[model samples]
Target chain A: MNTYDDVERTGMSTQDVEETGMSERAVLLDFPGADDLMAAGRVEPPSAQALARALAGIEAAVAAQEAGHAAGRKKGAVATAPLRGMSGRRRALVGLFTAAAVAAGVATYTNTGETPTGTRSETRADTASVFLNDISTVAATQSLSSGKYWKTHLTVGDSYLSKSMDFYVVNDGKAYKKGRQPDWQLGPKDLDWKALNQLTTDPAKLLQLLQTPPRPKSISPFDQALTLLGGSPASPKLRAGLFKAMAGLKGVTLVGTVKDSTGRSGTALEFAEAKSIGRVIVDPKTSSILEYTFTWTAGASKGKATHQTYLSVGFTDKIG
Target chain B: MKPDTRQHEERSDGAPSRDGGSDAQLTRSAAGDAAAFTPLVQAYSPALHGYFARRMPGAADDLLAEAWLQAFAARRTFDPSRGSARGWLFGVARNVLAQHLRRAGRQEAVPGVEITDPWQAVDQRLDAAALAPALRRALAELPVEEREVLLLVSWEQLTPAEAAAAVGIPAGTARSRLHRARGRLRDRLAPTGPAGRHLSVTGDMA
Candidate 1:
């Protein structure tokens, strides 16, 4: 029937069918077959194990449905989610790299613990060191379970650079998924969860490894400490070590309590850059990071800092 | 962050096809009949998977599961009189995709994955991939709405009406979009003297 026979069933005309066929041929040719995509996408055919997981999610659905019905049928009865807000600078950072590069932002690995030799500002003194050692102790007291992958969702509030279209274009910068909020995947690329847990809680080793590569050039050791310590799903011991290591950095100093743009209150740590002030907010209660904020300390973009908040960070049972 | 720029030369395939009578299976599934849902899943999963695979690679299965989960949870609301179960399912899938696209960023410059060059991995004709790269460029140039309709109709093998139902647009609008998209494609893919090889390929399609 030349595929035209199915027109009535498909609600399409003969010409529509032909054109669709032509165009569809182009799409289908891209993949070898269903299995090829399934493999690439890591999609398995509803195995027994998967069915169990589906059943669990389904149970949540049923309970939500029953609860909603009991409460007179809410519009949100479907029981799943997605979200947060957008920031321009956050978008630029996420947009600059591909999903693999951005999601796996810290994929670069360097086993060597050779600290880059540089000037150490003696002004940091013993006070900051003592305070940091104390915070790392608190970090060590945290008790959280391990998971498969570490996911972090963040948004940029304001433009990182001066809001100039020509400059933005010349920089060849991209504001990634401006409309769609994204959660970054941070494990399985350069380091695994086990390796992260096994690393000693020593500050020097933490600083040496993190200050390697695949990070933005503007990222200082303090910023590196924030990204690694704030963004990772590190174990309590490792987190403690990271906090201590960060404390040892010359420029990283505690800035006391602060509230994120979301109005969530947390202790703030600020890193002074030439033109910007980078801040990491840690939830004092859990010894976990809450946000990484950047404010323009000087220049045309001065006084404008964008805060990137962590929506959720956890270990999933498997890669999605 | 740059969008895809690779071109593909793929081997030809047979005519497009569809799976029908899913409405009955969907009705059966709603009645708590697990077996009834099996046939329906088997029949329609490919189209749904393909729908997501085109826009988001390596996410089809997860997205597909999310869609089905929504579909099954909301099965009681399915009104066959309004449209085909497959179309309704497509709508649910689109919702799931919207969520994923929101939750995760897209890979704009996905190589060997773009519609232009499916044959990049396949062992086939060396010159079969569009030499002019006009088709893909034209595709990129088409309006997002028009492109969605064209893709649904062409890529998903949905009739204009079904595509409309899937995307929640009117059937007439989808038809117009389909027509406009085809016209734009024709304009861009039109024969040029030096692109005779591509001409033969697209001409065969025409």
Candidate 2:
């Protein structure tokens, strides 16, 4: 009897028998007959040694992460992460390079402790150095491990620029998770250096544009928390307005030294400029700004060249 | 931070396996508790392996390893109230797999290892072994969503609810798709004549 005849005799519906056949056929075709494939030198289930090796890799990774945490604790790493904001100026500086160029720049600057030269008017500085100069202390820094960092480049009439943000962090050695609430208000979005640079490359035009701040459609959670906690980053025109509003507020200074368990110590300093322009952080000991950064962009507009500088402060603990 | 060390402490502390722990414990484990997550790793590794192995052939081992690593690195992001630890883990694994595929720029199938059904073993009129590969190819030919639903239920052995959870689809939609996929497969395997449409073998179909 044919296949269907046999199914009919066995009291199976046409559909049911067909399903059984199809499932079996798929298994048969998807994998060459295991016995045949094995005979032809196919590897069977992963060798036990391979599995052990995999488990070892996992165990090592887990151990390293734990050790990092313990080391952080010993260094007086703050469990409470501060509001680390990416100033509009800092973003504009790095967004002008391609991915390859960005990678090269990050590698050179981070490894040699020197800044990568770029076409922008300002001298290139390592992101950490910029933070140190702006903030007295840095909480944490980890390079992108997933190779997913996209790089971009910027240019005006004669100048082309390449930049990179090799390491990202908060103050006092507190690691920043993407979605966590900030201790103070930063911004509503996670604008990378590239996106920022694009906005501010022309400082004059940027200042003009800032007269009416562009509203981002979606804001990140970190920015949301930052807004709730304290001051916010405003448009250039609004920033000027904020400085005017908080002009009478007393300016305060904060300073502190953070030493990781590894014996790596960095100093942090914080300055409340106008309360509304927000606070500026700088490493008094290293004379580096660990967090706060500013960039000015100038693009031609209305037949006149213009420039605008944006100010942002890093979060660091210091007494001033 | 080793799971072994954590395991020892939990034993001494008289805390139950993490799967049996309160939400707080699960949350802590997700944050940075290596020891707290040991049970989670043990519990879900098999299911995760099975999940990948059934869909993409030969990927079971690598995907499993990557999934575990991702689960740990991203442990902080896990939201316990939204779903179970296993469900969250499977979601991460799927993302990781998608990322890997996108980066690698190659779509290669890892051949599956076949397991025979015991009932079919006793009545060997039709060799199921001969049918498996054909079915697999046919399944591949189906739309990705339909094939996913079919294999999720048939190969991965997930009930409709569990399958829906894995793929982030509604249960009823998944059920309907599964039915259509199976029906499509059957039609392809043995073309049915219009004459056969009148017969309803199971009183349910009429």
Candidate 3:
């Protein structure tokens, strides 16, 4: 038997291979056509513009790391601060200010014309709220469509749990895993096709529904909202309502445009609580959730990020 | 069968120790020195860009940029003790490719059918007309993992060990895969056979 050792020893020298009685050499050299395949696969080097952009991106990341290190040193904290890159941080701050302004505007609109100290509050609108509202409007414009089944393909990864899972669910009235035969349920709070379709499209009502429940304390209103957004075959109006409701949530803040795991760029929204942080990436054009990630901010699982990418979601007649 | 001289010159840790600079540069870059990363980028960007271009021709530039940013962010995780920086970079590229494919709703490996006869599974997607038809058919029929290893060696010019590192497989597995792929290709392309004669005529036409 010709072993791998004999193959490696034959080397890349044709002359030496001919002198040595190695069958592996003949195997390696017989495919002269491989050279053509290699030539065919050749591509031109990256253009100067692409190279420059890549360098700039790297430089920004470096600068962000350095800044994070400096901040950590000044605070007497560990040098493990999250590196949001310079551009991302700037965008996040801008989004925060916008969200804050929008909250103030909403508060002022609902104000009874006086505070505890009998002073009137000022009204303002920030960027993130406006962005989300705009997205909601676009989402509402999406034409409603339906099929026999609502199909979703999702990939989930959790660093804290050290688990990776993929869910391909096709739901008509009942949920099926991958196809019709096998029954499926997605976690404890899973809603069936009927529950999903019956979800009220009213933004305020949707928020109330998500908040009211005998749910675990760990499943926050935000988490519930995201779960529905990801798993449901909600109509265009419902999706718009979901975004509008999420926009009003206390801790939800825009993180600017960021790419998901799949490399498709989308606007990112983050909600940081006492123990964990949740982030959702939305394709504003279609108002669809591209990805959702949650990371523990404190305790044993601190800094471990779990994420789910919604590869696709659509209505299909057949389940597979 | 020309040996890739660069692979031979690499240090045990996998960093090219040609001038004893890459390892030091990588360390400095990981320490947040942006300037140190420039040389490393210049050294590997062409091959890395090619890696993306081969699989995803249209979005190669954007994918390359994304991969570099990711690599820079994760630079601290690159242990020279495990593999060379090139192998590490290629691994990153592979990940980027996987992500891109996932977003596009495509599988990296074409599953299901086990190609027995090359003619039955000729991959019409490949545009390499200059390559022998029989060999191309044989290649298209090779299992995705074996094909990946073979290409990383024959095209990317990585040794079996380096290819293993790039593909996140064991060195022994990579060598055996390479050996099997070579033997299969030779068998399919043997000149004395009637199938081989038919393939040669078709190869010229192509």
Please give the ranking of all candidate structures by lDDT, highest first, separated by commas.
Answer: 3, 1, 2
Q: Candidate 2 regions off by >4 Å?
A: A1-46, A81-320, B1-26, B53-60, B108-129, B132-138, B186-206
Instruction: Give a tens-digit lDDT track for model 1, residues B1-206.
Output: 11111112121112113323678777765544534555555556656666665555455545555565556545655657777786788887776665454333332344433222122221111123332344444455655667666656554556566778888888889777766666555545444444345444444331
Greater-lDDT candidate between 1 and 3: 3
How many clashing residue pairs appear in each of the predictions shown?
12, 72, 3
At residue B189, candidate 1 shows an lDDT of 49
Can you list each candidate's DockQ? 0.07, 0.08, 0.13
* Residue A188 in candidate 3, Cα distance off native in Å: 32
Q: lDDT tens digits, residues A66-185, model 1?
A: 333333223342322211244755543433332233112111211122332221222112223433554575676655675544445444322211111111111224433223222212
- TM-scores for candidates 1 onward, in order: 0.35, 0.37, 0.46
* Ranked by TM-score, top first: 3, 2, 1
Q: Which prediction has the highest DockQ against the true structure?
A: 3
lDDT of 2 by residue, B1-206 (tens): 11222222222112232433534544776545755655555545555565554344345565565556555545655555555454456566665555444333333332341111111111121132344554434444454565555544443334454456556777778767666655555544443453133223211220
Please tell me which predicted candidate would have the highest TM-score against the true structure: 3
CAPRI-style docking class of model 1 based on DockQ: incorrect
Model 2 chain A weakest lDDT span, ten residues long: A152-161
Please provide, for model 3 over A1-320, each residue's C-alpha lDDT reduced to its tens digit, 9 standing for 90 to 100: 11122233322333455456444323443353555665555567689876765654454334434443444465555323433444765654544454455445444322322332211101111123434555676566666887765666676421110001223443444534432221112223355556556656787766556555524567777777777676566787787887676655555554556789999977776767789988888776567889999999999999999888988777666645
Each model's C-alpha lDDT?
0.49, 0.36, 0.58
